[model samples]
Target: MKKSISITLCAALLALSGCSQNTSSDALSSDISSAASESQSTASQEESSGSSLQNGNGGFKVEGTKLLDANGKEFIMRGINHAHTWYLDEDTTAIKAIAETGSNVVRVVCSDGEQWTKDTENMLETVINLCIDNEMIAVVEVHDATGKDDKTALDKATDYWIEMKNALIGKEQYVILNIANEWTGGWNGELWRDGYTESIPKLREAGIKNTILVDAAGWGQYAKSIGDYGKEVFDSDPDKNTMFAVHMYGTAGKNSSVIEKNLKYAIDNGLCVIVGEFGYTHTDGDVDEAFIMKYCQENGIGYIGWSWKGNSGGVEYLDIANSWDGSVLSADWGENLVNGENGIKQTSVKCSVFTKE
Candidate 1:
């Protein structure tokens, strides 16, 4: 009987593992408690800041099959993922701090099930506002429950994305929609592909022609998943404005080579690529950060930090910087955001790197 129960538990674990890890739907760490309340108001502010970049009218119209900036210069994402921005419910201050790093893009994430609220639309607008207010770009991530049941999951996903599309149309420059965060489908390409394909027509119908990035299966750490994804995207004939995203964390037993390879694949395949999430907390991790940043900068790829606040499995909160327990944040895999400057030294950068600077 005990053996049967153990087998059942393991099977359940395997079943749950197929969903995206970022959408765990688990309780957030304590740090997010106070921050949750403010995230929603700020979330709506995603592109709210871009309006300020406007000319005589309401900012420049940003219509691009590909992402080219106002000057037609290339704009790539080199930024941090604001943790609990949706959970804590507040942290426009962190957005301001991110701008100091010479970064204009931020991956703003909300914990699971937060999007069902009408208030989410308002929050998204506000967050977009703050991002643009800080002259920063926002990569909006609705990292939420990806059901184990494929048909139901895909249908439910379509519903959620349609809502986001409705709220995000007409806004330009300050926001890009990342469909799901850290897909850990455990090799279920069918589910990922279906979810992505369904979203394109719906989003387009809603007038959201902006760049939409889709993540891969396998905890977002697998590179080969890109090949399958690339195939599916081609098969589905998705809107030309599609990109591929991957998340990475080095110390969490991830393979970095896959990241580099997948990034190349996405770029070579005529799709924009983004390291939607990464965190840097170690000294040596600086080198990796520099390489990825420089490569992405040169190649038009994008990246954002794992988080801004002090959540575990993420970089330390701004107050702690790259140190945990008063020590360096360690050689953990995702240690780039807190220290990715790559020996580029300046007061603002220094301030961003150490949190206390």
Candidate 2:
């Protein structure tokens, strides 16, 4: 989840220039724009696959806004987002250390050879095995698409999943595939809708069946998109095995009222949602992390704090642990997220998928 500040000069120029004269050239341009818009709408509809409850790998399925295990038990994701892609050296023990915090799930960041070193099939297998051994649900994500505008990177992420099909096919009980960390930088509901509706089914097509999780727009903070277009996205999934993620930061996670409103909106609207990434503080703005934890704990909504260790570039405070070995915890962010009231230790419940019961 990255946000690069940008200002489009053309938008400002258009505002200053006002409406252009409707000359013959302008009329022709208007016609072209209308046609392009219509064409895109039609293409989105065509590309969107119909809904199904196929249960390809027969592991977890979404049943009326709840994540159900193969045994039909509810699995709330009380977890943490581990930055494995950024901190490759910690790959060996991150899952176990996070599991020791009493978390039932772990969202691991990954790349598809696009931006960072590719997490090879062997690496993925290691990560998945580690989660299984530690009795945690592994939600692997592609980070290369973070804050991207085009679908090329998203498509590449899809292809990467297909390449690792052999490792993923039978692990549906323990794994969930997060399509992309934050696939688009802009808030184009149509683009986000069309992108997932078209690309997600490819996994089922390749026989890699796992519950899918898609992040919201605006670098995973624009939760309004979920309120606006969530139903359409849910209906687009062939398996109906999908969940939505919202990363609360300065924009959408600023206050207690705002946090409660966004969480209520998604749950009230009958869409399964999780707080994929959040922190007590950020350069973007202060996050009401206390309210976030309390709200999720009370509502039975899944929540995972920003990270375990290894954060930098002016946001080093996000690192929950002071060291890579997970010995020391940070003063504010780490302590609040993991051990404070309404924190993971107090609220986390292990998924039935792992327990023998």
Candidate 3:
């Protein structure tokens, strides 16, 4: 994904775009209990009107294509991606503002101590808490894995998560561990499978029970990666609680057929799949955002538009919102994503985890 020409002038065109590895088991257990307790006081009030009281596992589980809570109620993700790592200045109100847009989920970008500033354990706590406070499902991803062909970057991401296991100990229901964003190094299926198979056990062993989300290779645009080996990766998890994510842009999501095939291959096989990030137009190609939103809503698949703001390079047109506060939205990308016919506001259902009583 090379940068387009300096999009600085695109405005004229119309842009819119853990406790550590060594902590004792008992101590970890206690921390999990306390964190769960701390959030419940507020969580109970945030539940969806039809959602049941969430307790063990806080109600997030996968059944076919749907993400069901403890009550077996569906929680479809209709939300936007936030590049928090790249725009730290917006951290103060990103979550709050994202929630205000009627998003039931927020994919927060973070560095895994490799390509960008390391997100420490404390920072993870604050970020996750912010998501909960705003009643949105937090999908945390390590951005360092982008275009990485070498498994080293993937391993490093795993290690980073293990180190921050403390913050994730008991937040299974409120957060999803997106192992790495587009770990698309060479499109090697072996690396993707072996990487997750090896790392997932480490997380489950560490008591990080959050539903693990593994991105498809090929810069996350290759949906076949999941269709080809999604089951193995899903079963590899000791908890059998893993989901596959696909990032669609011009290459893979240019039309309705491509979109349906990619998503259906995974869902047809009885696995949970989600479109991790996508845009109406990209430096790579023109994305069929309309088909994406329409199909996902009709089929029960979760979808998050590729970002609120801070899009640089030549792809400034990808930004869904005009500013950090999200007060202004772009004509095509931003407006279509949040307010269009099949947009988030029209299709998203708040997760029972955040609103169930």
Local accuracy of candidate 1 as per-residue lDDT tens digits, 1-357: 001111001122232211001222344457775558556645655444333332111212222213444333345556666654433444556667666556667677643353333336766778777877776766776554332324454445456667766556666445676665644445566666666676666766766655566665555544455655765664453445566776544421123444466576555555556776553332112224455565555555666655554553222322223432223433443234444443111111211111221
Enumerate clash totals for all models, in the order shown: 49, 0, 17
Could you give the candidate ranking by lDDT, starting with the highest? Answer: 2, 3, 1
Residues 1-357, candidate 2, lDDT per residue (tens digit)? Answer: 541111011111111100011223222345878879877866775454121223345677776667776656677888888888767778777777888888999988888989888999998998888888998989999988887879998999999999987778778888999988878767777888888888877777877778889998767776777888887888777777788988877656778888877766577778888899888766556789998898888877789887887776567778788876667778898888888999989888887767666
Please report, as a residue range, the 10-residue window in candidate 3 with the lowest summed lDDT. 14-23
lDDT score of residue 230 within candidate 1: 60
Give the better candidate number (2 or 3) by lDDT: 2
What lDDT tens digits, residue by residue, belong to model 3 across residues 99-169? 88789999988888776788989888888888888888889988887777788888899889989988777
For lDDT, candidate 1 versus 3, the one ahead is 3
Better of 1 and 2 by lDDT: 2
Question: Which residue ranges in model 2 land beyond 4 Å of their true spot?
Answer: 2-56
| Candidate 2, residue 49: how far the Cα is off, in Å | 29
